[model samples]
Target: MASTPVDHSAPDTAARSKVERFRANPWLALTAVSFGLLMVQLDGSVVAIANPAIGRDLGASTAELQWVTNSYLIALAASMILGGKLGDRFGRRLYYLVGIGGFVVTSVAIGLVGSIEGVIGFRALQGLAGGILMPNTLGILRAVFPPKRFALAVGIWGMVSAVSTSLGPIIGGLLVEHVDWESVFYLNVPIGLVALVFSAVVLAESKNSGGRQRFDLLGVVLLAAGLVALVFGIVKGETWGWASAGTLGSLALGLALLVVFGLYETRQEHPLLPMRLFRNRSLTTGAVMTLLNFFVMLGGIFFIMLYLQNVRGYTPVEAGVSTLPMSIASLFASPLGSQLTSRLGARVTIPLGLLLSGAGMFGMLSWSVDSSYATMWPPFVAIGLGVGIVLPATAATIIGNAPVRDGGVASGLQSTMLQIGGALGTSVLITVIAGKVGSSLFGELTGAGVPAGVARGLEKAEDAVTMGIAPVSGDMPAQLRAAVVEGSGQAFVNGLHAAVTVTGVLCVLGAAAAAVFVKGRAEEARDMRAQAEAAGEPVGVVAAH
Candidate 1:
């Protein structure tokens, strides 16, 4: 029997065909990348709406509930830069597939967990997967798209990220109200599966061929330890007493470790984060701006969700629905802000956005037990518009300022700042609110005609409010129920006001920093053009306007 002659060129032909198909349909590539990014963004806030339900079902304490969220954030923040570095060294498509697979498995485990501890553990794993998944989205996009089309692709990427993040609470709320709390985690499973399949089929493998590849295991450990210590200190400050040894020691240790990490990075030939990037004033300013932005944004979301569900007695779906104005405004404002950045420059536009955010936080101070949706929606809109405008400008500033060779590092830094800021904001704000609520609850309740004994009892149970669990109306004595609800509502409002005021002050500081440090349009354009010329890439019109 004779064998047919082997077609030696078949593999090469198939490869060419695949490449041509991808080039012909860039939108299809975008769709696959966006699906993975959407899943990551969605997870960021979806669990927020389900927090109350998770607490009730697991009988978790306020601290435990916080850990559920913080664990994920800390893991994500700590590993993000490393993830980006790994993607650059290895194949992005391979890492992305592993990330999606791990994310799906973790999501399933989280949904099936019987205890809060299990949920927290699984959530951290999910975030680790997210850290791996997210950085590659931009990397893959950059690899596939031409430089001329990069800005447009990034714009669409930013839009998808913003929309998915905004939709999290709404989707989680609907699931929690109609299906189950577990449904929120389970929801990611299907999304991940679809993303994995599409990515495997459409995504091409890409890696940086220029530098020597090395993993900074020591840096990763130090960074993770520092963050955990810092966040732990903040989260536990109320219980440990802010001046106590536990709180002071943890904070001091965290700061010292970070300082060490910075010093170590400076010495390393191939550092996890190249310290030289911070030499760019605009990048530093943009990083600081993003940090503050998420600090206010995430912290505000945590408290507002509690107020709507626990204080105002709205259902999860209703609470989510009430926040629609902010999301809608953000959808419009992000694209508009991109245009404004081109005309006004990040110096003016970034500060303007921060100012709006500060104003929105100030407006939130007027919220009380008696405030209505009309009053609430205005602040929501202000915040949405501010965040919508600020995020893209800040991201552009960071990425734009970097040498083209260091783009991945610049992007990873931005994401790391975002997650860390969110974690810190949630921790610090929750601590402030908890401390205020605990100190004032008894006095306020007694002043409202609650008996001293009953006031003491209610004070003991104040965690219900701070942890996002509503007191069961049926369980309370009819006379005390009304007073208790009113008193607790006032206390929560007071705490919320204090937190918002603090956030407003930070926003003002961020705005001032942006004004001082971010460059004007002409200077930034010149710098970008120089970078492009140095790299031997054509200076696209997108670099100008």
Candidate 2:
């Protein structure tokens, strides 16, 4: 008797109100998207700090520890393009929701796993989920924000990424020191839940809305297999001996598969990656720059953390705290880089950033067994500023210059470069360190008065350091302990210097590539207009900052 007529306009009115609120304060939307991105970035770095503790608890060998990290990276790299395509074809919001849920579940599973193999498997699953979430973060931002404000939004996004990744070690260190290694993985559970709820509530649905999309199953398989083989060969080369049939065959097979994949994509009607995208020099250059940037930065960080803990006898917490200067510097430098890009363009900023990073890597050559944090922080700050500037600018360049229909693909490609570069960097640097240590450890130990028999027996010290274990374990003769400690420390420093030198050289080459290949803002705008016109879309600039 008390029932009234239904208000049919209520749903539409609520939807309109939400859209208006989003328009009024896009920053709120940015906050919502950035949370998921922050979680993904945090997980990438936090696990690095926990790797040693994980090995200790699970009794994982050096190769298994390397697999723990590489498996996640390789899986993410392999699936990222597919994830981006899925988001484009379906909806970004839906994929993002699934990604967050999967990531949370896997994180919990990893924490609960008892064996190293289980942890590695679950970590790979976590990476697959992350691959799905990451590209959508930028796609949604591009969808919501206009080009005028997009540069600043990207800067803010980069800042959140830099800060979260930078602080991951500190957070992980505290968790591992005070709680346990499992606590590091469990930390993601609450953060992920909060991000998932916020994303569902605050984010709007967006998709390509273009012609019908197609999946390339063969492309996916080839890429995944090729990358797995490549990374495996690089990671295991030291143990397998560079000249061994196993290592050489893996490398050759991976290269052949990749070559075939590239050729096949060129002929496909709807390729996973459009071969024509490479014609856009800015996009190509940006992708390469991102790859080189993370290669040097992440690889260096991996060894530095080990050096701090295993060589210098610092605890995980102490090692993490000592690197705060770099993180703090990056916090400020990111915004400054955004401002610089708005004025100077990526062509200039990117090269300058590379040069600065190269200088920082060269500075690391001065490191020694006796060097203190005081000597290290200056180089840290330099590197932080360099990465802070380079990463955001290149990200903006690639995404801004991309066509609207291809935003998700561009984002995924950028992410793919980053993960692949990081994986390769870690593998190559670890290999370099192992080679250097293998050659030098025996001589150093013998020179330090370690008997020839003991020196040969302690040859495993190279593996120990690579795995983040101290050279001298358990009680030993005082003289022998001293010899072993000194020898190990010196050998590690030598390897670190060699790795840093290679990084420095690569950074210089990256600068050259950026200068030559990245176009200016005016040219980039014209190119975007050309692309939009060719696609029969709006004839104005699609993504000019």
Candidate 3:
């Protein structure tokens, strides 16, 4: 009888082993996905810094240089939703691998092409790949992580993104200065390789287990066309003039196509993006918050860089170095925001973050051509902390509210908003700066001791002044040159003040919207669980509370 005792411990041991494996799988998946995120973010940030070098080596014109960036933006913004749908329909891991692999290949191709045209074409392809890769990273995370741990995982992901973005200028400057521009593209190879390995080894394949859902071909065409038109208009608005027929026509057509697409989707049995998802207030609010937040963040960064380099005459490396406090603070703030969102809810945390960000922008109103580093660094830290806090909180709020089945689509929507917001921010702020400088240049120049005749002659230099560069020629008298320089700097600072003032106001309004709309943690958890249950996923899968 004693010898016949059952070996029940074997079953218990096996169960423990299974539990341990599942627990660790999420983090491993995070690691795998982050590489793709890192490569994409780093590439985007560094490429802008590398543009001048790219132009010099390839004998590119200004328009050609602009295309180098625009082609990628158009492709990325257009294909993002389609990419997510493809991943949702097929396998996220499959598309993800394909994406990273294509990105790597295209990046290499860009360096080897030896022509600006080829670089532009390859950049488009790279954007398509990025569109595919980005949302799936979130999709994979959404699938693997338990609801309880999702926010923290997303927080880490945000941290990685923020840090990489922050590091891009510095890295690009170093590589372009010391190495060659090609190195920036080649940098992706090793990172991609490691990502491929980890992803292949660790990521479990997941898809919408629906029975052979038909692809929304028409929806794809409409959405892509709509997005392309909209983004093209937004990107070109500053150059084409905001009220020009081209911009107005493109925007109108885009809106019309999107409206048609929405109607078409509502009729589809298995639509690319489920319109029903918008039924969740949290998702809608998160999306709006994402758009507005990036509008301020990216737009603000644009002018700051101009002020630092073009006005204050700092080198690219020095400007990047000055922003280190922001990077460091962001690293800390992301995780903290995640914890706060978990406990106090997005309603509290998002507004708090936005308020802090608004205050930071307001603080920057005091910056001048001769402003000290002490004044500069505090606002940088505040912005870093605020952006870090908002990034994850919004991401978690958006992705956490959706069912696992539609995770990729939701992720894509969020990403599309981000791209559009960034584009709008940069373009609109540029326009604002240019306009403000144009109107104030003559007055500022005359006031700064330049003769009225000379100041009137410099009216044509508003564009240069907007960029923080004075249009003084070396042939000019020393006093005149100094006056021109002083005037130009002041004019640019005035533009900066205008841009930040608008941004600060936007942040305040965005915060109020978030407070009114976003649900608390408990309510959000219940909604998530209910949605998961309706989708027939196990309730325990998202049991946040």
The prediction achieving the highest TM-score against the true structure is: 3
Candidates, ranked, lDDT: 3, 2, 1
Q: In terms of TM-score, how similar is model 2 to the real structure?
A: 0.91
The true-versus-predicted C-alpha distance at residue 385 of model 3, in Å, is: 0.9
For model 2, residues 1-545, the per-residue Cα lDDT tens digits are: 79888987989999988875664355766888788888899988889888889999999998899888878887788778778777766787788888889999999999898999999999999989998988877767766676667777887888888788878988988888789989888888888999988888777777765667577888878877887787677656767877899999988988899888889999898787677788888988999998888887788788888788888888777877888887887888787887788888889889888888888889989999879777899989888888888888888887777766667778888888888777777778888888788788888888878899988888976787554454786688998888888877888888888888888899889989898889988898788778878877642122221
Listed in order, each prediction's TM-score against the native is 0.88, 0.91, 0.95
| Residue-level lDDT for 51 in candidate 1 | 86
Question: Which pairs clash in the backbone of model 2?
Answer: none
RMSD of each: 4.1, 3.4, 4.0
Query: Model 1 TM-score?
Result: 0.88
lDDT of 1 at 118: 99
lDDT of 2 at 274: 73
lDDT of 3 by residue, 102-211 (tens): 99999999989999999999999999999999898888888778877888988899899888988888998899999999999999999999999888877777777777
Candidate with the larger lDDT of 1 and 2: 2
lDDT of 1 by residue, 86-134 (tens): 7766766677788889898999999898899999999999889988887
Ten consecutive residues with minimal summed lDDT in candidate 2?
536-545
Deviation in angstroms for 228 in model 1?
3.2
Worst 10 residues of 3 by lDDT: 536-545
